[model samples]
Every structure is written in structure tokens, then in C-alpha cells.
Target: MSDEDGAGAGEQLSDDQKQEIAVWFLSNAPAGEIHYVAKDVRALLRDEAVYEAAAAEAYPEYNKAHLVSLELPDRSGDIIITTYGELDKNNYLDPRTAQVATVDHVKQTCTKLRPAADEELPSAYIEEFRNAIDMELSKYVGEAYPKGVCAVYCTSGKDIEEPGADFGLAVVISAARRSPQNFCNGSWRSVWTLEFSYAFQLVEIKGKIQVDAHYFEEGNVQLDTDIDRKDSTLLQTPEDTAVSVTNIIRHQETEYFSSLEESYLNLSDATFKDLRRKLPVTRTLFPWHNTVAFTLTRDLANELGIGK
Candidate 1:
């Protein structure tokens, strides 16, 4: 038998095939980085009833899945948002036993350890989960297995001097990491091999869309963490999605202030509530980490010129 087969596979793979897979991982799901997070999130929004169990792992701050799943299937996957408290402070890599090895060698190793045929979770699982929820979101969306699952955790140690530049989910993740002294170290437990997929409506991306945000003034933006911190269960806590949203928007505004200075449209309080009701769903304008600065797609950006 060759050296390529995983737990259940055929003969060993060629060096070229191994390298191709490794390149694919770097391009698509580079470990610890967050790209296209819409996939793994639908189940959380689709099945709020499972909030209690998942919260302990998925969302420690809040529970009660809502509409966050809609935007999910759009951009989702298992993102290395952050690692556990046991951070690898030492930049030193473990001693290498062997000399230089081709990228294919590493790929072959990964293939044997874990099967490469990764696909989004099936709708059947989502349905299995939905059936378990108490609130029975059947009215809103009581279908079956979710398309995927995405977990985002922030690594504890890193050079965060730059506004938003890190190995994982970029700024969104680094910012999400709570202070180490705050207990739980701001990181959450999550499933490792999960990913998600979604197709959201009201999808608006103005190439020139930029927004600079101001604090709500009333301090409503200040997160109320007492409740979440006290709870040992994740589902019981309030998902940090609300605060997470506002923070992202603020960060974007601050980082890309020049570009997004006046590019945003404010939502009314009621509208904000409408958005909040969707919790974690991509439909909600989440107020992503810092600022809200996403330029329109080249295709959409041209529209402004037409009107101008």
C-alpha cells in the first residue's frame, strides 16, 4: 500500500496532488484566518433552541439563535478566529526532526490525518437540530440540515499594533478577544472541522460605500457583560453579536476613516431593533468590528458615476 490514503481512502497520493491540496488550504481555508464566514453560521440562527448547549461553545456571551443564518450561507467556514487561553507565547516552532521537505510532503501528511473531501454540513443535520429547538423556529425557517458551520476564535498573543492585520479573521477576531483579566480570556470553545454556506437577500455592497460612525451617545454601545460573564452556560448568555457588530463598524470607520468618513447611512432606533432581531444573521448590518467601510464592487461602483 502507498503512503497517501487517509482513514478510508485508496493508495498513497502523488507529490503533485499533495502540494495542490496544501495550496488549496492556503488559498481558501488558511488556518487561523477568517474568510467567508457565512457558511457555518446558519444553524445557530436556524435553531435557537439548541442555544444552551451551543452557547457554551459557539457563543458564550449570548444564546437563542435568530436570523443570523440568512447572511451565513453566503460567506461562512471554519475560521480560526482565536485560540484557547493556552496560547503559544513562544514564537519558537517545535524542533524540526527532519531537513527541508517539499510542500507536497506536508500535504500528504494532512491528507492522511484528515480526509480532504470536506463539504458543508448537510440540510439533514440542520433539520435534525431544528426539530430539537424549543422555540420551534418552524414558522420562520424550520427546514433541515444547515449548509455549513463556521467557528471564529481570536488567538491570545499577537502584534495588534496595526488597526486590523493578523493571521486569522483579521481585525474582527483580534478585537473580539476580551482582556485576559476579564476571565475566559475573551475566547470561546468551538467545533474544529465545521464550515457553512448561505444566500442572503438585501445584499448591498456599494463599491464606494463608506461610513464613519459615532457612538450612540447614550452609551447604549457599551456592552453589558455582567450577565454573560456570570453564566457558565453559553446558550444562557447573550451572544456578543450586537456589540461585535457595532465594534466592527467602528473599527472600519476608524481604520478607513478617510474613505468611509461620510459613506454610511444611519439606521433609526427601530430599524436597529429590526436588525438586532436577526442576531448574528448576515441580514443584520452587524456594525462589523471597527468601521463600516466596504467599497462597492467595481460593477456597483460604476452606478454612482451614472447618477452623478
Candidate 2:
């Protein structure tokens, strides 16, 4: 097909054709040339149909795919070549094919499903709880870290079952921070990372809430020093300096983590209602009857085609 016609019609090329285009582009395209690739290698540099077909063959999982150059956040003149896939209705990539879960994925997977009256908490609830924990721990973007490298994640689950409790909630909260310091005449760069993981099950007993909590925390410090010994001070070698600095920072970070854990524990035990009130986006609570009524009204409107 003519390039213009193919472009206008949005033609779906066959796999073999796409493969041919991809092979041709790879043979002619130079490495690390992001501008050429970003400007639609298929349409700008070669036949549109040929270029698109090749992309499809290479990235079969994406319905529509294209090459893009993404610059590193460090502004180090480094660029990564990756495919930008077509977004779904929710403006998110499909989680089944994506390596990382988006915020929408967390919301959908972690939000507790309403349970049937008097039924045991669903097995799915445990999976959701586990997923939420994993999601929170895995995040590496937040204000606390350099350039938003680490994130704080929190998720909640309701209707947890416990003896002598009317209702229960499962809460997971995690945070991480990295602080970097330059010392010894700018010869050494030290990065200190502190991480906190806290999980709690809050159950209401005798009209008062109680919490059972567990936590795991750690702090890491690493030093990147100049390879040359010229910058070393006469009093202490780089190795000795590193050891002393690491020890002091590690001790301080441990105390910091302990303090944070104690504060959160107190909040969970003494001010749980206040904590719970801050979690959800909306404070307004709707009755089950109101939801049922809204659903029925929507169904009736659809049947009558009133909006249409």
C-alpha cells in the first residue's frame, strides 16, 4: 500500500511484513541514535507500513507499539530505547504484560471487596494483603529520597477475622529515605538509606480498638571514594575513615528507625480512629440502601434509554 494511504487508513500489517520491516530498519539503523528513532523510524526514515509492521513483530504483546527515547532523570546525556505501548481505557498499561504495577493496579488489587454477611473473610483478602505489602515495599519513588527515588506506600484491608473482635483492619505502611553526603575534600560520597516496614491488624474489642503489630527495618550506608590515594589524609586512610563513618551513621539510622516505629505504634494503638479517618479519599459514608437505590435507578434509566 502507498505510505499515505496506509497511514490514513491505519492498516494492520501482517506479521511477516512487520518482521521484514524490522529487520531492514535494524540493519540500517545505527545504535544510540535516539532522535532518528523517536521521530517515527517507520514513517520518517522508511515506508510507514514497513516500519509499523516491524515494531509489531518485535513487540507482539502491545497492540500498537512505537520506539521512544527516554532520557535518564540524572540528565547525564544517557537515553534508553523502549516501546511506548497503547494505553487502555484507564490510561494505564495492561498489568498482565507490564513488569511493574501502576497506582491503579494497587487500588484495584488492594481495595477490599465487600463480603457477604456472616461469611469468613475471603481467601482473596489474604492475597490482596500480600500484594499490597509487596507493592509498598517495592516502590522506589518518593520525596524522602534523592530525586524521588524512594516512595512511601500505605494500603488498608477491612473485615479481617479475629477472636472476640467485631471488626478488623489490616494496615501496611512503609517508607524509605536516602541521604547522600560528600566528605574528605569531595573525594568520598556516602549514601545512607533507611527503610521501615510496618504491618498491623487492628481489631475492635468491647467497643475499643486494639492493635497487633510487627515490623522489620534496616539501614544501609555505602561509600564511593576516589580510587587514587593522593586525596587521603595523613591521620586516617580512606578505609579507616569509611569504617568509622559507616559505624556512626548505621548506629544513628538504627535509632531513627526505632523512633519512627515507636511513633507509628503509638498512633496505631492510641489514635487509630484518627489514622483510619485519614486513609480514604472521601469522608462521606453511604448506606447500602443508597447504593442499591442508585444502582436500580441507573439500570432503569438504561432500560428506558432516558439519557440517550
Candidate 3:
């Protein structure tokens, strides 16, 4: 009933509208047949003709009294019907609006860093760095990727000895997007997933901080039935008798990944430079250095077995 249900988008349907659709389906859709087997009567009669005559006489009454339900078939047609039926029932939202909102939500709330519990580095300094990185990444949200969802997670080492050297930090970023594209008279949903793992190192030279980073990126995309399928036979191959959703997903995964690889490459390059620039920088020790000196001193004392 809420926006969070069913793909996290789409308008809520009124009770009247929902009831109307249900009634239409029950009245017009295919209804399963109900057959009554009079086994005991047939055994007692011991006459095929008598049993048949009795069955024929009682058939109309039984049919009128029993309930017949509409059930979807257990094949590809069911999939296509259910998918589009739900969308129409809920008054599905526009794909473009859903895509943009999803990306914005990810940008605002998905960047996170979790340092080890035993880390000896000053928490304040670590938090400052994380905030800085998150801020830098925010600028690329709607720019580098016009539509998609992205999340970033960073983990740091337990012991960081140097202020501006490699500290065993690792960052992983995950991104995805959904698109509904028209095919013939119907539509298909294309979903993409991209993951990037970065080996991160920091360097400071002449009061300026820089990032020395290398990352490995991989991506996958899949397509699923979204709307009407006029000719189900079109989805099947000459050698096959039925449509295989698994094969369709796998084949699209490979094809779309290759086609979209260039866009992801551009995003990666732009992000690397953004990290290097460390934009909105202040003179020496970043903008959060006002109290970092004291915190660093305390950390050093604790490391030397002199302070708690």
C-alpha cells in the first residue's frame, strides 16, 4: 500500500479501483472447470448406463452450486500477465521519476565508513576524513550518473602510524539502475549492477592532500518482462518449445554489461579525479584540524603506554 512496497515506487490504488479490477478478472478471465466424481453411486448402481444417466441428471445442479475460481496458468504467460497486472493495479509511477529519486536517496544516505574497534588512530580525525570523502563523492551523484543508485563503504586499519601515508584502507562501491524500454508492443525492464573495489592510499605534500588509488571494477545487467507480450511464441527459439526466463536474464546480463561498460568507465575516471582534488580544502591539516592536534597527542601517549 505504501511507496516502499513493490519496487519502491508507483501510486497507491484506491479500494474501489482495486475491487473493480478484481471483479473484472473474476468475471471475464478463464475459470477452472469443476468435475464431480460419483464413485460410491456408480459402485452401488453396478450399471454403466444407469451411472451415466444419474451423472447427467445431477450435473447442472452440481455445476450451479459449486464455486469456480480463476487461476493463472503455470507458464510464461502467467509471468507476463502477473507483472503487468500488478503494475496496472497499483497505477505504476513513471520510470524516470523513480530512477531519479532512487539515485538521490542513495547519494544522501548511502556513504558510510566503519573503522576497526581496536584502531589506535584518533576517532575525530578518522571521522573528518570520512566526511570529507563523502562530501566529495556527493558532487558526482547526479552529474557523473544521471540516474542510478550508489552506495560506498570504507574500512580502515587498526593501526595507522603515519599522517599522510598508506593506512590499509579499502573502499567498496556498489551501484545499480533500472530502465523500462519498449520492445515491439511491450516493454522490458533492464537492471544494471556495478561494483568497484579500491585499494586506497593517502599522501600529503606541501599542505595539500592527494589520493593514490587503484581499483577493480565489474558490472552486470539483466532484462525481465515488464509489460504486454502479444506473441509469446516470439520469446521462444526455433529449437525450444517454451520461453526460458533464466536464459533471457543471463543473455541480457552479458550484452548490456558490454554496452554500458563505457559509461561506467567515464564515471570511474571522474571519481578518481574528484578524490585527488580533495575539493573544498583548507591550508594545512584539512578544515577539521582545530582539535585534531590534541586528539593526536592523546593517541600517541596511549600508544607509548603513558596515557589512557
Q: Sort by lDDT, best first.
A: 2, 3, 1
lDDT of 1 by residue, 1-308 (tens): 33443523555545444444333433332111212221233232344333223322332111101101111111222112122211122111100110111111111111111111112111222322212221222111112112221222222213232222212111111112222122111111112111111222111111111111112222312211111101111111112322332233333323433332133323233334354444555656555333322322221122211111
Best by lDDT: 2
Cα-based lDDT for every prediction: 0.22, 0.27, 0.26
Which order, best to worst by TM-score? Answer: 2, 3, 1
Cα-based TM-score, every candidate: 0.17, 0.22, 0.22
| lDDT by residue for model 3 (73-155), tens | 22111011111111222121111112111101101111212222332232443434433433443343333333212221223
Model 3's C-alpha root-mean-square deviation from the true structure amounts to: 31.2
TM value for model 3: 0.22
Candidate 3 deviant stretches above 4 angstroms:
1-122, 158-165, 180-308
In candidate 1, position 175 carries an lDDT of: 14
Candidate 2: clashing pairs of residues: 18-53, 140-149, 141-150, 142-150
Model 2: what TM-score? 0.22
34-82 per-residue lDDT for model 2 (tens digits): 2244346555535665555554443322111111222222332211111
